[model samples]
Target: MLRFAGFELDQRRIELRAPGGEPIRLRPKSFDMLRLFAANAGRVVSKQELMEAIWPNIHVGEDSLFQCIREIRTALGDEGRQLIKVVSGRGYLFDAEVSGDPASFAASAGLSSASEQEGLAQQAGGHAAATVAGPAKKRQFSFGLRSRVAAVIAVLCAVIGFAVAAPMFAPGVVAPENTPTITVMPFVDGGSDPQATSMATNVTDRLADGLAKIDTIRVVTPRSDVTTASLANAPTRPADTDFVVSGELQRSANSWTLEARMTNAATGEVKWTTSVAVDTENTDLALQQSRLAAGVGHELAVRINAVLYPRAGVASPLTGSTKVVVEQALASINQTTRERFTAAQTMLESALANAPDNLDLQVTLSALQTRGIQMNWYSAAESTAAESAARSRLERALQAKPNYLPGLEAYCRFLTATNNFVESLVACAKVLSLDPWNGSALYQLGLTQIQLGRFDDALANFKQADRFDTPAVSRWTWLLGIGWANLLLGHSEEAVPWLQKSIAITPASGRPYMVLAVALQGSGRTDEAKAALAKAMVLRPGSTALNVAPPKRNASPVFLEAGQRFIRTLVELGLPAG
Candidate 1:
């Protein structure tokens, strides 16, 4: 008898039963499959091993094995195959605790010993095998002997009952490894209309589809056969799912509103939430639905990825001190003052002194030092020295953790600033491959595109960054990129709104105003253009057409001509001639 999480399997009788003594019938092959999984609980069993064990003498395709797995899950009442998880690109993992009465049952049943099992493995196409087969011999028993065996079985079952039942009353625990698992529940319709319900379902489907694109994430598919009783008595943790996404969709006369939130399944703690509104009056019905679903889906993907992966190629299980140091360093950068920058550098240096091997700290310190040099916080020679040291430390960190998101992002930025456009593009693309929802990587990719004079491609990437905006309006660079891209393409009217939004979010910078001035000048708003130029001059002293270098990313004369025209426009808008 093997007992695991409210279920029992009797090897002698070849039967499985639920906690209520109700027999849970499984097909012959499914029973063998369950036995193998139970015997190796909490360990991932390879597909090849499973196939060999279940179909020892015959050749079979993978579909047969998949069907057996599906049947086993069905019999066990395992929602989302939580007990028999499919490890993507690997095999299946049986994530459960196993314990049982293991004395005379094996000997009485004449089950194969280790040596016999090894022989059976050799028979199974030379693959490493699993033991899911029942005993080959059946012994006839006297009535009195049967009565004695039944008594012994009852006692063993009672003891195993307590063993499995104790965990049901215990605190919920969720154990996730490298990949984060999420479950997206159907969005509930907040409005009375039945059509709203269909729309809500569409949103949920699209959201799941979008999240599935991320390689490091596992999206749980809820069973359609789940009953009302099953949901009412659902496990607190929903098996192995780490996060549950649920929300409401409401529709008004001509607009729809969708709100969603992610909650930690075990703790039931809300991790993140967002609400978006869309107007559908002017758009076609199908197009509106798609746009709404895609928008929310993209937003959710970014938010989830930001929390799970956080940084490119980095799996997040950060230690307390490392998280604190990283947060402080980032906050210091956002302050954008010389004093805060120095303080951040000092804090990182002190932390690194204690734990020089900490890659997170090393990467962050390198980025901060590089940013200080770019901002002209140090003299020319000092800046050069700092850049060299930062680059060396970054190279070391990358050597240790090549896919570390923060390091890759910083390296891309550094490469872009140093005019290594092609290399920057490659590094940023690598980051995106690891985390498609990474807005920072997308922004960097857009900048690389701008440098390469791929204005249309740059626009698309910038818009994607906006769609996946993790911190809402946190990234002003992509907004400015969009505006500048439009201006370069002679769409100054379209550039104004984006440039204004960038300025609103980041007024301390002079770049947006400089571009805004040119945008206004091109639109023949001379007075407004001069006013904008004045603001830019105050923000960035000594601005002049002569000193302002043109972008070096031009592939042909057209881009060069456009750059000259913009510089001429800037000069006409009251910038110094030099």
Candidate 2:
């Protein structure tokens, strides 16, 4: 027996008991997890380590592990979250003092029953008993017949299962034959200034390096400087070229600008183009080259990724009319209003129904639903359905396109919301490594940082997202993040404008307004605070001092304390006590 926190894990009896000696039921997996925790009590258990221990050969999703976590927490009645503590960006820890080598205690409790003792003695004397018995050839023949029949049945079942599931698993087994090929011609320096020439060369180098990291596409970066007009006007393109990427850099007043485009080489038609500017005045010279290159490069990469992996590489970006419907869904991701969310969901569902295998629509809907789950728009049953559908779609999408930024972003957000921060952190970093200016990924990263109590890092991440401001639909999310971080950091006055900007762009989210109320209250505008709170209450009905509070799980003590104070302020301003 091992004892801690008024509970005893009786290994001999294979059960857990509360202080009152009542048995606590647990699923087999949950019991395994609890036993693992008991063995390593008071130690931080990394998620990867835990998964490997619990599931040796199986490649299960984090959801399985998260379910077990929920089970353990419920069984322990760890509402305060003191027992199973989450170490943000790390893993989980079962923090408690446990007794060691309590075999005598199990004996005292009579957990080692007489039947169990007899079974052990029988096992020890089994070989001797077998010698005294006959060979029993009749029994052997009967067992062999059954074994052969079972083997035949198992073989048939395996073949049928493989045939049925091959498509689902094909992405990993088979290499893609239709992988898109892209060529990056060296960017032309549009200005005569030496600074502009240097900027062009740096961006040209970095852009190629960045594109090379994408596994889904084949990138060819030519060394020789090629004029943008040459690639645009030339009749011939490389024989294998599917797309040609060419751009020009110029130094304008106080900023460096990059005008970049991707062209369909075979059709001699322009595919995509964008203009990006990096402020020389605001950014130090050291980081300017990266900003200029990634600004335009990130956009082009997303466009290329969308064309190749129409399964929503970055926020479920689609290519055609389906894209328009998907964009409606993306809107809910940006604004987060309950009505808009439902409407967008209905639209996507209808569109997806028309084309059930549309992987792009699947992931887009998944991403949208993840946002709904984050906003608590789903009931218990609804949340389960939403999470299940989204998880299936995301897993399938990822299996198909591992480098798709949109899918990665969605999965990253899913893991973050599930309190699986360690994997979420890695996912966010992967998105950034693929496209450094990915605003969606940055927003998710900032969220993780906030939960970790790294308020300053979170603020910087949000601010960086604002600066890059790529994929403009996701603009409001980062804006809200910045304000949220500022409020957490106690710079309430500074948080006001950012929060207001976020609300202006996407006024549907009651969360932003509720947070805005905090900023206003902290700024000592009592009347304005009450007004903001009223609007928030109107936006989100049935909110209370209790339910309105953000979850404390995995959030650092500093963040929890700050959140408590913010909740107290909201209550003071008129939030209900329920």
Which pairs of residues collide in model 2? 313-406, 314-406, 315-406
Local accuracy of candidate 1 as per-residue lDDT tens digits, 1-578: 89887888988789999988799888898887888777666655555456556665344433356557756776787745578875542356888877874334333333354345434333431211111100111111000111324323323432343243223212211112456778777778886787887677655654564454444467765765543224324473456677777788888888888887777776667888878777777665544555565556656665664675355444333477767987889876633656778888998899888777777887788888866765556776887788788777777766655545577778767666655554565455445534555667777777665665667767767776665554343468788888988998789999999999888887664657988999988888889998998998776677678655443542336566777788888887778889
lDDT of each residue in 177-279, candidate 2, tens digit only? 5667777777778758876775676566556645654444566654354444455454645566688888888787888778888888766588899988778
Which segments of candidate 2 are over 4 A away from where they belong?
1-186, 189-244, 250-257, 263-271, 277-292, 307-324
Question: How many clashing pairs in candidate 1?
Answer: 1
What TM-score would each prediction reach against the true structure? Answer: 0.57, 0.60
**Candidate closest to the true structure, highest TM-score:** 2
Provide the lowest-lDDT 10-residue window in model 1.
137-146
Tell how far residue 345 is off in model 2, in angstroms. 2.3
Best by lDDT: 2
